[model samples]
Target: MSARRTSRVLALWCPDWPAVAAAAAADLAPTRPVVVLHANRVVACSQLARSAGVRRGLRRREAQARCPDLYVARDDPDRDARLFEPVATAVDATVPGVEVLRPGLLVLAARGAARFFGSEEQAAEQLVDAVAATGVECRIGIADEMSTAVLAARRAALVAPGTGAQFLASLPVSELAVEPSLAGPERVDLVDLLHRLGLRRIGDFAALTPAEVASRFGVDAIAAHRCARAEPERAPAARPPAPDLTVEYPCDPPIDRIDAAAFAGRLLAVRLHDRLADAAVACTRLAVTAETAAGERLSRIWRCAEPLTPEGTADRVRWQLDGWLTQRALRGHHPDHDEWTGIATIGGQAERPGASRTRRTAPPNGSADNTVAPGRAVPAAPIVLLRLEPVEVVTAGALQLGLWGGEGEQEERFRRALVRVQGLLGGEAVLKGVLSGGRGPAERITLIALGDELSPAADPALPWPGRLPIPAPAVVLVDRPEVILESAAGAPVWITDRGLFTADPAHLRWGTKDWQVAAWSGPWPLDERWWSDGHADAVRAQILLRDDVMVLLLFGRDHIWHAEGLYD
Candidate 1:
């Protein structure tokens, strides 16, 4: 058998989509500088914000500092997907078989559409116009592979067939990390490592032999290597999934509510994942189908660059169900209606020609009824059954599970447990600690809710003048307790303005307890916010007691000594 050629894919990308969704949801003016943040880091910013030096990964404080008038919004994946449905619907109307890579990105086979529209360029223009009609701006790219097409979409370029490799040749290796929603975010680190190894360009990395990349990097890098070479993401061994692998869930009362649909989708996704795992295979392309009470069948195919994990599978199902239910809700009246209007605005921008064909009105109950154009058929009833079928499967080796019973298995189990607990207790119930910049132990740590982006409050790489030495305290006290450090002469020990100790520390007393100081380390003074009225002047020291217990003590300008932390 000869080698299989890469498929021609068309990718549509909406830049700064999170910012756009946020602005539309908040009804912010188009000229306003907007940023959407996750875990206190700027994940997406509007064009206005970008012009002000705001970029992804910037700390919230810094982003705001760069643009003081920036309007900040939390990242809401549901909102992004919900608002993007019309755009996707518009594209689906223009060309069938649209595969959603994520909320703001879409991909499909370009051959048929190109032929129908007379050329690839024409199809790209038509798709762009379709999306723009719904009040959103988009860029389209056509290439021989989905990954290549995604990158091209960022530049609005079209790569001629069989020339994907040459087209990607001079692009920076960092391009591998672009559109993280399509390719995983793990590519960011891979790109950095590639740069350090002098593989600055995509072609340089692609030039390496497969065996070389396999020996030097992990599974992700190997997948990226294939992409760099403009090859298919799946290995040639990919086969059709077994018929028995299909999983389905029947909704008792039929699910019309978005929350209910989300719950049902998760259950079905887990079941499908378990079956795939049992079969020792992983799904690369998933077919999500839903049957409504009116016998209406809705189906969509989602293609992933990486094998679908349970979370990824669940997310796709939820998005599809949400899109289906939202479209139903938007239509407001009976699905049998043939006329409706398009969305009025996206990212707070006015709709273009062919936009605003639908007018959303409030029902008697005073709630808004969101409706979209009647281009695609809407389900006439609530969804009664949800099914998942693996359209394409590959051996589970792609998942990189640990050999036998190893750390990978253990880590996966542990992560599942955390997710379970989080599901039961709400997203903020569980917390994880992230290292951040500060002079004191407590200030150096930031507690973030699990499932959020683990961004530190400050950059740890920056120099902290009065930071504690090599080993951090084992325990940082949330409440500072008053203590007394005195000399053998029975006078309170103090640090002079010149930074000299008035006397050698002899004893320590706190709450009816006392200990003799065996040895002590001197005052590391910190004058924080000295230029402002909230300025604080403090000195900290490490003290060892006769009992072998160690304590971190601080003396503030209040002339009070407080125990700050304890060392094990």
Candidate 2:
């Protein structure tokens, strides 16, 4: 124990981070336990839930079977983070600088603060109570070292200084945070090795020599050895929080369909953008929150491109939400219920670990936006993202807030609503296209024009490295060039060869008939250079061009005529 480093650690695991997060966020009194599933997959189980025999690693179905009443929520680590930021900030205020373990953990150097606040017991209670005000219910553990504090927080059992080794000794070997003993049947496990070594618990492992553990377990052994004797956990982070940002829209006209949920998400995003601008923070998390009148709430979170911005943030949230909502989703066989629930109350947050509150959104009232020249682009800045959250609930009906006949219900409101209607009535919809950039094969290029939008159109805004030839033509000839026509007078009718040969026109010919000069126009003829590929580079400039009449770059040998656009 003397050889091990000392630490003041605090691990606050709320059994389930997301449920507490959602409960803290909404007006609903949280009676049900919430479990945040990572992409509908289980991550952490709540304390209340654990009492039901539901464990963290168990699958949703398995856990449900164990504790049929467990409220299985999705694991949105990012959402949990976004929701947790303010709470963390509150913690930092209480103890200046602390290390964030994750969305659910934080280890603070509390030796001085504990003394300054009067006592260890007093500080922990004050700290927990202060954070709880942010809507998240948290627990605290004060120890001389980190790993021990983690265990203390976990077991809600604390240990005094110089007693970390004893604290660790009492914990089960499985509590050392090693990989599961069984990862399928083929892979051998540490539990077997520990058993073979005659080590039954973490405390027993503490008695082994560090050199011996290193010989057996390699680098990870260093951490395990430190944990066994109660040491300060080495944080493998350069800085605290990763930068990310997300904006959400709660509900519009507010109802049951995914579309309404998506529509409200846009407005929430815009509002969040405005607030973030004033705060000078850019993040990469986009979260959505949905609430059902029946009290069920669902949320979703995501990551985006680097060097995030308000515009880029808005663009992504709109696109992704639209993709999921506008498209119909077939609900798995509950046959009787046909109506979909909607979203409500969207929020935005930044996710920058160790974010100091001093950063400003815009430049000071009179100062420049950045050091860049006044007319040029501003230098890119750093980002701080809040966790992203999304909620979708199976509600009874849309809430109608009458405003002398405002937008009506979020789903069915009329003419100027935020969402585009897709059912019975037809309207010129504002659709999206993934416009492909550059030029090569027409199949590989794009430019958003008029008419309807489709999938293959390729969004021009996305990064595209390969494009077409330089000085690309503005237009190309189409409709398979009109069949060349000539007149009876052997003077080569229709369009004359009028080229480098001379400025002349004798007679004209068209579709097996000859016509005396009605109004002779151009003798614009071009021939390929001797060294050139025939007709490939043969558009040798000519003056005879007209508006109404087409100067067909006719191909005899291989002349590919491109109409080169119209004059009018």
Best by lDDT: 1
158, model 2: CA deviation in Å?
3.9
Tens-place lDDT digits, model 1, residues 1-568: 0132336788999998989989888988789999998999998999999899999999999999999999999999888887887777677666767777788998887877777778889888988877877778999999878888899999999988778889999999988887675567788999999999999999999999999999989878988999899977654237977999999898999899999988988888778877888898988888888888867676777778778878778888888788778767766545445554454344434335555443223221121112222333456688888889898898887775644432233567777898899999898888889999998888899999987899999999999887888688887776888999899998999888887678998989988998899888877777788899887677888888986876655544566788888888
Lowest-sum lDDT 10-residue window in model 1:
363-372
Instruction: State the local distance difference test value for candidate 2.
Output: 0.45
TM-score of each: 0.68, 0.40
Error of 2 at 209 (Å): 1.5
Instruction: Kindly provide the TM-score of model 1 when superposed on the true structure, using C-alpha atoms.
Output: 0.68
RMSD of each: 10.9, 22.7
